[model samples]
Target: MSDDLIPGDESSAADAADAVYRELLERLGEAQPQPRLGATKRALELLGNPESSFAIIQIAGTNGKTSTARMIESILRAHGLRTGLFTSPHLVRFTERIGIDGERISDEAVARNWDDIKPYLAMVDAELTAAGEPALTFFEALTVLGFACFGDAPVDVAVVEVGMGGAWDSTNAADAEVAVFTPIDLDHVQRLGKTIAEIARTKAGIIKPGAQVVSAAQHPDARQAIVDAAAAVDDPAVFEGEEFALVQDAVAVGGQLITVRGRAGTYPELYLPLYGDHQGRNATLAIAAVEAFLGGATQPIAEDVLAEGLTEVASPGRLQLIGTEPTVLVDAAHNPHGAASLVAALGSYFDVDEIAFVVGILQDKDAAGILTTLAPAASGFFFTQSESERAIPAEELSRLAASLDLPASTFADTLDEAAEDARRWAEEAPRRLVVITGSITLVGEAIEVADDREWKATA
Candidate 1:
């Protein structure tokens, strides 16, 4: 199963990569994640364990994992290291999930890696079927693909983000030198657990023996779970609000000016071109995670190099401005925690007095919690559903809004219609903004529309 790997012809690379991605989609979807790593581990083992080829910084959390991982990869790349980043639930294309040197993994690379790894992946799939188990899932196969691509790139370091709860997440197959956690909240409750403590313990599984741990501040139960996990491994841990912190953040023109006390150094008043105070905290964790990984939480990052990295990081679909004129924006805030952050950012960052919300929630998410969180800030709701099979219908959101007595809202079967209607409504009023939230899928589609229509250039 090892390489006699032939390179793919570049002429048909896009078609070939699309076919490979479709095959991955044919497997179980990411929403139905199998809580096991055996299949992925087997596939990687056949590929001669490419996950071990580079140093890893595995991230686990309810939110901010992608943003944090992106920041970490940017910082490491800025320091002149060849870096690989693996994130999940791509907004535009599958290629967005894997990054090499701060750029998307190319179509050519995807096709080439799939050609090399397909034989090994097929071998694992056959083994599982024979044993009366399912084949590798979408996430599981994608996990192997990310590692294979990174190994082929032969990167200096890889920043890996967990697709779900840490214990059995396919990415956890890689033993990280630094196991990092963002705030553990009640997301994917059915898959992870019902309570915060249970979820935190499962996420803390990334903390292997001899691995260093870094974390954001957590609730008491979550904090204890991480502390226990680290103690059990006898590894050192540095928690946010204790070891390092987002010392200060103020609204800046494009984003924010922030100060961070990293594990090793203090980076004062850096310009991060991203919205939200949550993002400032996410950067703080990224800085500390990098400090812990590169310098073992002892040696400070050069201030100029650190600033260079922070300024270059862009996390699309999270509090992003997709349009202007009528001032349309999108935030991938699927849960109450994220929705709350969006509300706070709106108050702190923009001058809008009222917001017309375009929201879509997947079937498994807590729609009520999200609606409740946004209700206080909403001028009205344009209830809509994403194209995802998991998305709840637009009427469902309308019904939820009624149940909460929030407002009289309108429903749109398609995102485009909802956005169009919302924009028109916003344009008629002063200090009114169109803000899309409640799911990544909706936000991604909104972004696609914004790009196609040239929303920034035209009204």
Candidate 2:
């Protein structure tokens, strides 16, 4: 709320660019469930179809898409290929949504691309208005920017994480060489569909002719939908537990080491620095995707490269331990399934005397379902709101937490204060932990603050 808190460029001042972005998203939400791909198509046309400039890997799922895309990008780079990764719902910086060879797109680069694309965005809006159609959405504009950035980066391959569902998502403009699915579930019901079969049908829209498809183990209906989709295009399909699987997974002091046996070959004990047993499945899916994309290459990837690449990749806000002694675990679990995974990971991986949580859910998410899963594991709850306006108010979230019989407190109207309170509560208990979950917006804000502090110290 302070003037100094606003971001600025040389010519223009920032009055909550974050707030402006959130407002745009809110406006888009007012028009949600518009599953038509026209806006994306129009935006791509105005931008000269930049997504076609490179080979692409399209990844889609209800959960784990970001993690899987990051892993696959890392694996491709490990093979000595220049890779570009485009993902969504960034935890911290907007530049995190687009990266090349593990480096985030520079702020200057993003600003430059924004300048380059602004006029096209205006034209698209004008055209849509002329046609009496809804204007380009925040996600649609951002997806165009992603394509432009990747086109400018000019990497050999671009790994795109589908925003929302795969079929009508803006990123679907690109013809991907491979399509990956990571355990589809019922999350985005309104836009995608109500049932698993219907949702799978929408997600399966990303599959193109002759593209190799690699999917994690799926619900029966979902799996059948994917099968039907691939068969329609004559695509070679690899399914987890049938064509590939995690043969073994073990945790150690360093991190998780998982052996993934794909249809092509068995990847032995790939050490990933990420925590959680769920990550084992993610790593296996990444490996399977890489093998499918490589098309049976005779040259084997060096063990050192695979191990080093897997171990070194960074996935923030997914069971990240931010503070020691009264430990703080920050995870972006925005839905029931994700919250369940976090609960399982916490119980299996960390040993602590007590667990406290700073929890908040957005209006669009499953608040009751998330709380139902998290409250059983959490000893205390510090309910708060994310920076997003769509965030459910703290009092409502507190009431929801009360339904679970969890000791809960609603803190100062914001996530930062709630996180501080959680930290304070954890400080009082021996071997205590404070976890932040339920929304990526909260995770992003927390990580941005941590990074800013680190930079100030070094500055």
Show model 1 residue runs off by greater than 4 Å: 1-11
Residue pairs with colliding backbones in model 1 are: none
Report residue 385 deviation for candidate 1 (angstroms). Answer: 0.5
| Per-prediction TM-score | 0.97, 0.90
Residues 280-357, model 2: lDDT tens digits: 899889888888788743445567767867987878789886665556778999999899899988887888878888
- Model 2: pairs clashing at backbone N, Cα or C within 3 Å: 91-444
Alpha-carbon RMSD of each model:
2.3, 4.3
- Candidate 2: list runs displaced more than 4 Å: 1-33, 296-300, 407-412, 449-459
Separate clash counts for every candidate: 0, 1
Candidate with maximal lDDT: 1
Give, for candidate 1, the lowest lDDT window spanning 10 residues: 1-10
